[model samples]
Target chain A: MRTRSVVAYKGPSGASVEIVKQTFSSARPKPARRVSFLAGLHGDELEGVYLCFLLVQYLRRLKETEPGAFLGEVNVYPAVNPQALCHGSRLWPFFSVDMNRLMGEPAGNSLPAGACRELLADLKGCSDLAVDLHSSNQHLAELPQIRIVKDFEKKLLPLALQCNVDVIWVHPMAGVFESTLGYNLNRAKVPTLVMELGICLRIHRDFCSQILDGAIHLLHHAGVLNSSRRPRGEIKMPLVLKADQVGLVQAKRAGLFAGRVKLGDRVGKGDKIGDVVDPVRGETLEEVVSPFKGTIFTLRELPLIYEGAPLVRVALDGPDER
Target chain B: MGEAVSLYKNVWEKGHFVDTLSIVAGLHGDHLNGLHLVSLLSRFLQDVEDGRLPGFRIAGKIQLFPMVNIQAVMEGERLWSFDNLDLDLAFPGSSCGELADRLCNVLYKHTADSNYALLLDASEKRCVSIPHIQLLQPDRSLRRAARYLAGEIPGGGPDRFPGLGIVRELQPTPAFQLRLYNQWIENNVCALVLAGGRSAGIDPETNGALLANVVNFMLAVGVLAHATRKAEKGEARFYSLENERRVSASHPGLFLPEARVGESLRQGRKLGELRDIYSGETLEELFAPQDGLLLTLRDYPLVYQNETVATLLVEKERRWYWPFS
Candidate 1:
């Protein structure tokens, strides 16, 4: 029910790195439920940082009137990537390496490796569930959703699906199983989930709200909030697919490009996706085609494409699913 | 030539130390995907396409390699270094620019008269939290076509990051090459630019997919292929990365991925999961936003929080029938 902070580590320059924790919990023995969420793993991703900002603003105010009225703990730390955030980059300030990929390695060995070792040690020592927030950048647009790998599915799914998001991905494989904070929670047998909002290099009010509301709804489901804030829609179980093949379609000859498809459109197995035209030559270079039967997900935005630059991505369907 | 662990040393270091989920492993000449792609593209024009495209077959090929950050690549460092100054902040590339700039100049010269699409392959040790495709063009139609092309790449969209790209740096480069691609050639070839895939090494499938996508896209446009035709492989739901998506992991943990590139996904889908290599604690879950495709999947096990796990490119719900299925 209160905010908590712990020094995660110290920069070589000696600036203390801290784990800013926002907790909402009740007093008595097993008085209520609790939820924890963290964001800004990539310092350059400022949206989650802002969403966490939005969360703290409201949550802090709610505490005053209710006075720990919620059932359990609701903790949030807005920014986790300190160095990268300061410089507007994706990696840690000095390392120039990504922080997200090192979850599986030992702490001291990773950049920001010493991150809140003391704090996580303690949270793991007590916490029950956790969630991480993220935003998508330019080029890709998507609906917000929750991701719950297998082990956590037992406790997390039924409860996680309560968020306003659209689908839930349940994976139980090994590749998805290593080196992540959420993976750590599931390993500890603590239920956890990750919420993904597409593209946030800048803020999109709708996308931001989708993420914020989903988080709040999750809080309600977890019993962290005592009051009822009705969710807009029901969270559906996921419809999973395994992307099998990937390749690039190039321009046979150089020329101006005329794209025929839009994002999120369903394309037939052999539909015309676009065309290459020699502007001055007054002729068509080639007919860009769809290689498979699936939704057309993306296209290379640049018109002047090389002979082999990627043009569009086709999501292959299950042979029988179609 | 390498120790057992050195097969993917750069990736190992990045994956284990930097927290990079997936790595693009490039050995010696393999860093030439761009040239190879461009060459492949040049070859297909006369051989593959049945005379749909009208142009002189062999006038010239431009290799605009204007910027080669050899110091950075060799040292596993970022910020193109010359006598020892960073060049990313310094652009329009100087004629006498050292290391990176000179490399850029040389690159520009190679493609100085390319007369066609410009393909630039950039690989290094740096990674960003929010990743995207940087498109440069002044022409609206060209921009439109590229924007459509940009769709296949994740993170750069209207609802996403706003800027067109890290400043349109290609106009001059391509113009420089445009002159070259057109020199002595009856029909001038346009320049195409591309970068971004797993770094530190190579992901063959990702490379192949990126290549194949480009091929098919060209076919769709009627510039390369005589007709647009679907492959026998059926439709695939490749995960287009959510806006500028990057995978991250906590410190001091062994990172791993549960998903591979080109995997099908549903919203809330688990593309991969991570756990503590030592204690076996579950750390993170890499998921998909909606019914979409998976582009680049992580190949390594260890990770850091901000590292790119795998770019999970997603798409709207659709189904393609595979022969086996």
Candidate 2:
């Protein structure tokens, strides 16, 4: 096990922040393949942090118990934006800028941009494949899933299937995704997979364990770990989804939303999914319904919602599924 | 369909011309300074068109979009309340998208043929600023045009308005790719952002100075025939990203500002102090690193460690010409 600082910044008050990465590799001079795990890109997303912790613990145990099991290298970046993670903010506290958005940007005088440049340069060719883990914001709770842009769909779908997520969604690309770490890595031929699970600021142990198993399975499949060390269990096959096979439900009025459906519930069309009640007026302002027969992949976890706020996202399971 | 965003444009033209200048404001609902300045310019243009003003008259076409994001302004929010979408970042927008997107598309198309586009905006944070001009990746010709609009000779000194003296050349980042200024620049139009004041509030003196600056720019660019008053002159300062010194708080606490924006300060000047939220003891005091002009100061009290409390534009020595040296 080796730990190194990827980037460091000294503040005006004599304090400093550094992004560190831990590497575990075989005793041999060269490894078969190198795999990287990135988490805590957004400071509030804690699921990936916990998942990384679990993976690191497992790797330490495997390295001690079965030294021959490690055939390749595994790198874990537990927290990329340490300042934001410490402050529990979604953005870099100083500039109030989203560090994730600054990835792949040209190096600049700003600390955030400079840090991103260094991080990208370090991670560019360091691994044969990488996984960037994330969790939804405070407003929404997402089920375990992997979202891939359509341009990289063919190259990423097989790898994404290796992870035990609920759905593998291939959606059309938007301009905003061009600057993301996963998109840039994939563009650079590093084959990075973006995994989004659970919600921000909270950890779901079951989900973390599920992803931990999937990560180990991926390492074994990539020849980074011995087959004998693979977790004993059937890896769930995630449902493949396309952009059109998703339905979004939004609140029609501003009020407190009481969700009637769980995160992984299946419902029929026109089913009652939630109710937006106006507590002040003592009236149910909106009775949100499922737009299509599908499984709920994302639900509004926070009760206070404004008009036009997304309440739920459903992955259609019938004819829409391909 | 969502509620339609009505964009009102007031144009002043006296004769046929090949060049047209487009001025846009109110892209963000909270940027009321720009809105007020645009309104003042609109009324002034109307007077000139009606031959009510003594010396000024329309020479070329001048298009004034006083309020672009009407819904946001009505709600007193920075972004559209319904969608929470920033209209400023929806440039070259899609007609088939949301309300903000459609509005951006219409505005982009409407100003596609403009020779010069000026955007009126304010600080993105909860702070105030002195009226200044911001250029994003400006080319040589655009820089010269900006100087002319600022009422200064191509490389000469003595700016027309000290209130709008600061000119900051910004490097476009990924976040700026969707800005209207970037889109216009890509399309070969000279674009400039005239920003100052605070969001969601009005400063009479600042808006008045901004209005004067716009009028002078119009005169300099030949959009307006003549100037109504003598141009005010002062030395304009140009700064790049390197010239910016951002002072951040070292502790999380309630920040109490000791200085105001636009004030010139010496090195080690106290900018603010962070006080413990519960005990009310001074946690740390922030100071300016160099002699510079304060461009922005944090207005909101609550701040976390490493949060920027104030931004200063460092003053640099003027380059010595060969003969002068």
Please tell me which predicted candidate would have the highest lDDT against the true structure: 2
**Top model number, TM-score:** 2
Each model's RMSD to truth, in Å? 23.1, 6.5
For model 2, how does the per-residue alpha-carbon lDDT over B95-181 read when each residue is reduced to its tens digit?
654446778899999887898889998985677776778987766666655554453322222222245667788776666777888
Q: What is the C-alpha DockQ of each candidate?
A: 0.01, 0.14
Worst 10 residues of 2 chain B by lDDT: B316-325
- Where in model 2 is the C-alpha error above 4 Å? A318-322, B1-116, B121-148, B152-170, B184-190, B195-207, B218-325
| Residue B77 alpha-carbon offset, candidate 2, angstroms | 10
Error of 1 at B14 (Å): 36
Model 1 Cα lDDT, one tens digit per residue, B1-325: 0111111111111121221111111111224444344444444444433444554222222122312444455565444322222333222333443233343344344333332343444433332111223333334333333332332323333333221122122322212322222221222324334454435544343344454545443433333323335322222222221232433443434445555443455677776676665568766666765554444454445454444455443333322222231
Evaluating just chain A, the predictions reach TM-scores of: 0.74, 0.97
Q: Which stretches of candidate 1 lie over 4 Å from their true place?
A: A8-14, A27-31, A116-123, A137-139, A148-156, A170-177, A229-322, B1-325
Overall local distance difference test of candidate 1: 0.48
For candidate 1, the per-residue lDDT at A276 reads 85
